[model samples]
Target: MSSLLPRLHALWTKETLALLRDRHGLAALFVMPVIFILVMTMALHDAFMPGASIDVAYAVVDLDNSPQSQALVRRLDKSGSFRRIAVGQDLDAARQGIRENQYALVLGLPAKFGERLLAPAGADGQPTEPLTLLVDPTLNPALQLAFRNQTAAALGTIRADELTRRAGKLFGLPVSPAAERDWPDEIVSIAVQNQRSIRPPSSVQQNVPAWLVFAMFFVVIPIASIFIIERQEGTLQRLRAIGLPFGHILAGKLLPFFVVNQLQAVLMVLVGMFIVPMLGGEALHMPAGRSLIHWWLVAASVSLAAVAFALLVASLTRTSQQAVVVGGVGNILMGAVGGIMVPKFMMPAAMQRLAEWSPMAWGLDGFHTVMLRQGGFDAILPDLLKLLTFAALSLTAAVWLNRSSQP
Candidate 1:
């Protein structure tokens, strides 16, 4: 037992020294993720935010020019979410603006919008012309729905105001047009998490963990490089000759890289908390108390999955070049599907379902459960189970592959 410990210690020392010498591998492990986090966080700053001013411009065509029509326009502008651009009153000109890419949407108030302000669509036995929203076909469907919803909200308020004014007059009660000018109808968005209210995750919150998961899986580069080199130089054979089991060799690779992945987690978290905010991005917030422990549990599970997956890649490949190509391409593919390159929330329904199969996705989901949802260990159990199960399976495959390759 004592001899086994000493041998494992020597293997760990050898791995640490080998990794230190691989400058390119070290940079891939650390430098690449920092750049991705900073760039993507700043670029996507407003995307995940609620009530961030949208850059997509829309034009309103007031066909009626009535007080009610003009009032509706004013209400929409006051919402301050979508920018309202001025377009010529001509309907054809508005359509041309959309075609020319001048604006993405145009809201046209139909004639008699004020006269039918209190009328239902067919209450008077004549169908009322509804508001028209002409949109550029290329515009995001989400943005289209947002504008439609904002207009509906504004119209509902207008209808409520007109109803109140008419009811006051009928009851011989004094009412003024200005009385309902500013309705306290603004909706405040609060993200519900852990039975508490907080803002939704900022860009840094997303990019940090996402790119960090991507970076963790990148241990495959260094692991495969070193493994292929050992095999080529007969270092692995020498170790096997000295009575070291394949499990010990795999354990040696796992521990050092596992520690490296944790260092990566700490460094990336510090970058998100301190560095990103300095670069004009929101700082990441971490959970406190037991939630922090849950976060670490997730990080540890991810590290195990990452290192084990690396070992599997190292076992499968025969050369350093093959390792690089295979490991690099594999990490990219995993990141692409795993919500690293693009957020899962933004993915199509089919794509999101596919993400459920990615180990990186499980890790990211675990981190998000703790950090974003303020979840306890119970909340992250499913993802942790997925990652750890993946690690066990990968490590088993790696050991089997190595043993089968032996003469």
Candidate 2:
């Protein structure tokens, strides 16, 4: 046992030294991922940040030119969320702005708008016609809904003030038009209920895990390339002839890389937890009262899958160039299909259904469940099972292929 311990220790030490000495390899394993994360985070910063307001251009066509119509436009502009474009004289001008995607909504005030409002109600004392809000149907649904609600509230307030002014005029009462207005005591109150009592994880929390999976997955090509290069140089056969068991050989090669990958994972988590807050992301929610066991399990499962995939690629490709080409192409294809490049929710239904086939998708889903959903081991069971199955299948195939390639 002591003799084998020295052999294992020597092999591990040698592998670690080789990894440290190869600056290019170390950079690929560590610095490359950080750079990728920074680029992606910067690109998506606006989308993930809270209160990232959009500039929604609104083209108003006020045919009435009445105080009521002008007041409504002023309210929308003063809100600072919607920018009022130059008033379009005709519907064609409004349509042109929408066609150019410069304006998301258009408000057309008819000539009769003020006349109708001042006129007496129907016999039943109800409004004869409702105010019109013309919105671009192609705008984001959430934005459309928000604009609709805002427009509705603004019009309602204006209508109330207009009615109150007319009422005061009728009685010759000394009342301020605003004071006489029957605006609701509470215009709008939002009550947010966090039923879980735990603040949901931010985009960084969800993205860190998903991006880490991608970072690790992409590194598989370079990792396998190292093995393929050693094979081409006849170093692998030399090591085997020196009496290193294939299992020990594999372990020695993978152990240091795995340790490096784990440290990268830790660094990513720390950065996401600390630095992301400065960029307007919220603190990552570490689920209450659980040890680091879950994190370790997740990392282990993902690492095993990554390493097994690398080994499988190395076994399949006879040349290092082929391994690099195949691995690079496969990584990109999988990344695209896996929702790493885009949010799954934005994809079409068929494409979303297809994402399930990519291991990257499964990895992202599992990570999201644990980090974002604050789910426990039970929630990640399916992911764990799928990864284990993939790893086992991949490792088995690699071993069989490697043995068959030998004399």
Number of the top-ranking candidate, with TM-score as the measure = 1
Error of 1 at 155 (Å): 2.3
What TM-score, over all chains together, does every model reach?
Answer: 0.85, 0.74
Q: Give the per-residue lDDT of model 2 (tens digit) for 194-312.
A: 23533333466656776788767655665676778778899889978887777787777577667776887887777677766766665454544552566667777877787788788
Task: Give me candidate 1's TM-score against the actual structure.
Answer: 0.85
Residue-wise C-alpha lDDT for candidate 1, range 289-404, written one tens digit per residue: 99889999999999999999999999999988888898899989889998988999999999999999989899999999999898887899999999999999999999899889
> What are the lDDT scores of the predictions, listed in order?
0.91, 0.72
lDDT of 1 at 181: 65
Instruction: Give the poorly placed runs of model 1, Cα more than 4 Å off.
Output: 1-10, 85-103, 110-112, 116-138, 167-173, 178-186, 347-353
Q: Model 1 lDDT vs. the true structure?
A: 0.91
Model 1 clash pairs are none
